[model samples]
Target: MNESESHGHIPAPLGSVEPHAPLLSVPSDGQLLYKISSVENLLRSIVGNYLHFNRVDSYADFPGADPHDGRQLPKDQQGNSLARFEKSPDFSAANYYDQSRARTYACCFSLENSDFIWKNYANGSEKGKVGVVFEFGRLRTMLNQTLQPGNAALKYNGNQCDQIFSVNYGIVEYVDWDTHQANVDHLQNPIRYTYLKDKERFSEEKELRISLSAMGIGQFALKDGSMMQFPSSLQLAFDFKAAIADGAIQQILYASDSDSDFLQAELHKLRIVSSKG
Candidate 1:
């Protein structure tokens, strides 16, 4: 909810409220809108589709592998330095052009489920409505190839370049603030981010910050200060059914501010009434 939406609803006075008060919900509001839930859902889908099995070995994970040597040593069949580190999963295809496979890092941004950053942004409490907070300790760097074109779709063939983690959905699903509805358009600039060679610059300092600009298109700056614009398209299909069927879903949550004890209380009340009869 935006500040406008938040301000529209004020909590009722204590005297006017009841423990089991029935609340009304907007079952069908036609106005096009977007919420933090959309982000959560999309992220969950990304994790299921790719993040869960990102097997690219980190230098730190390799015994005695110098962190500074991460840039070299790993080479593909051609002996050319690998563009990126990825696990060669037989089931997952690497480059769409070659029909080959390799390890691809599944980079993601995590905000603990309980974090109330969304609430602050919604209520206009965040100054820029732009800066974000990322836990560096939980950070993961992605393939440099992806940074070139965040949009993985092949320009001429309509093929998603990397089947393993390439996003298949189009821009039609993104929320367009101008129309205040969902809009679809090809990405002129694919949303992309790149981590600096010195990953420890921020972690050594023990600080993480996310930057956002929300007026027109929301842009999020990665911890490495790489800018990944909020996609003008929605690649994660909003179809929860398909997502679940394909195992592209991690968790589902339906949350509300209503009393958590309402259901149990109602059942108990019914039992008492029946006993009297």
Candidate 2:
């Protein structure tokens, strides 16, 4: 058998990130739960929505199966020996398969916090923060848009009830292997895609109305450990976003660098709020 045949892997779709293999050993501290919980809480706080975490596991029949390693699967179908040996068909298209058949990992999810962030804040830099604040009706608009049959909601419906009826019992007519497979990736991944798409609608280029000096801070530190007082000639990066249902901020790092000339840095989301009139 060829080297690819000896290993078990399937080609990933273009632009999609590679999946990671199951951990051989159990995680030691279970701190992953805590780290994930913090993110969930941040999400909840930002968007008044809840976040949930779920994991899937799989084993690697060959090397380079770890998700973080970034070793992409060979394009040829030779890498999936387990499937070939079992007389299974190739799985290049997007669908759900077992762990024994291919590498697997968990996918955590929550509502699109970027929606809340963007709509709450005006399209430009207000005061000192440099991100959108979701509008009052934006979440409602997003939910209405999402649930409009054949949209992302139908994909997440698990039963495909809505999708099936859209074309006169189309979903029921095609529930089997010949028709479709139950894959949650589309539903789970759309949050980021939706966020990016929404971001494109806003033109925040010239609306920034705040100065770096106006941001409240006694001291700041650079990655190089350089320290400086506030309100100096040096520039600052600013970012802000709404919390998810679980009260956690969406992944920060959405703003651009303030200093275009001499310095460069992305701003970290600040958890603490300061009050100064």
Candidate 3:
């Protein structure tokens, strides 16, 4: 086993930064994180040895999802909006460039095994839904390796683009965006915003998020002589076989014995064990 595996905690990698310094702590190896989804989705992940991450923008379509997910601007101490520069065309273009280059793709897990997750996320259907538990340490290590610099790449306009990759994982913080004040400098780090959610989501979700970002370096000249960059791919598929080999998956929870039996047979085909919830 490697040092990280033995230690049960993940160290932030090259491009990962803690903008919310004191509040976020890496979860321990034994910490159980739950992901509730359809049985088909859960089986697909296990059979494919990968997890799919959707662009931050895609999440805006979810019910009760924060509208300002990735576009939230920092507020000054006096509660003033510090986005006055957004009105300028030049600044707007630049902002769009930055936002596109640093676009975040994320997958969510919950720190709790609440009925709310089963009801909303798993559709509350015993035959079609299930929850999977993962060990944080192994999951983090797998993500760090899968997102390492050259393991993934971005393309724009049919051309390969130079990019810097980063991966971050942490417990999400529920905050009232209107009342929260962030350092102006926080805007420079896109992953930081993924950790913050509306306070209304706190009680039931208790979310843990894994976010991946790529900052594009290659640029194209706009008609106005300004430079802009964008990514063509808005999603990422990361392999988790290594984590599974490390016993990252703890258990598969099913609502009924019949469901458990079906899962066991399916999992047995993949050499994975299944248990009743």
Q: Compared with the true structure, what per-residue lDDT tens digits does model 3 show for residues 38-140?
A: 7777777767666767666665544666556554544532222333243342333235324643566768899888887877775534557778788887777
Model 1 residue runs over 4 Å out of place are 1-35, 38-111, 121-239, 258-277
Clashing pairs in 3: none
TM-score of each: 0.21, 0.20, 0.70
Q: Which one is best on TM-score?
A: 3
> Least accurate stretch of 10 residues (summed lDDT) in model 3?
1-10
Model 2, residue 236: distance off in Å is 36
Tell how far residue 49 is off in model 3, in angstroms.
2.3
Candidate 2 ranges beyond 4 A from true positions: 1-23, 29-49, 52-77, 81-155, 158-277
Instruction: State, as a TM-score between 0 and 1, how close model 1 is to the true structure.
Output: 0.21
What is the lDDT for 122 in model 1?
23
Using lDDT as the measure, the top candidate is 3
True-structure lDDT of candidate 1:
0.24
- Who is ahead in lDDT, 1 or 3? 3
For model 1, residues 1-277, the per-residue Cα lDDT tens digits are 1123112233211111111112111112121111223323333443443222221223344233224211211212122212222332221111211211112222222234433433322232211121122222121111112222333322113323322222211111111212221112311111111111233322221111111111111122333445432221223223333333433333333234322244234434433111221
Model 3, position 46, has a per-residue lDDT of 64
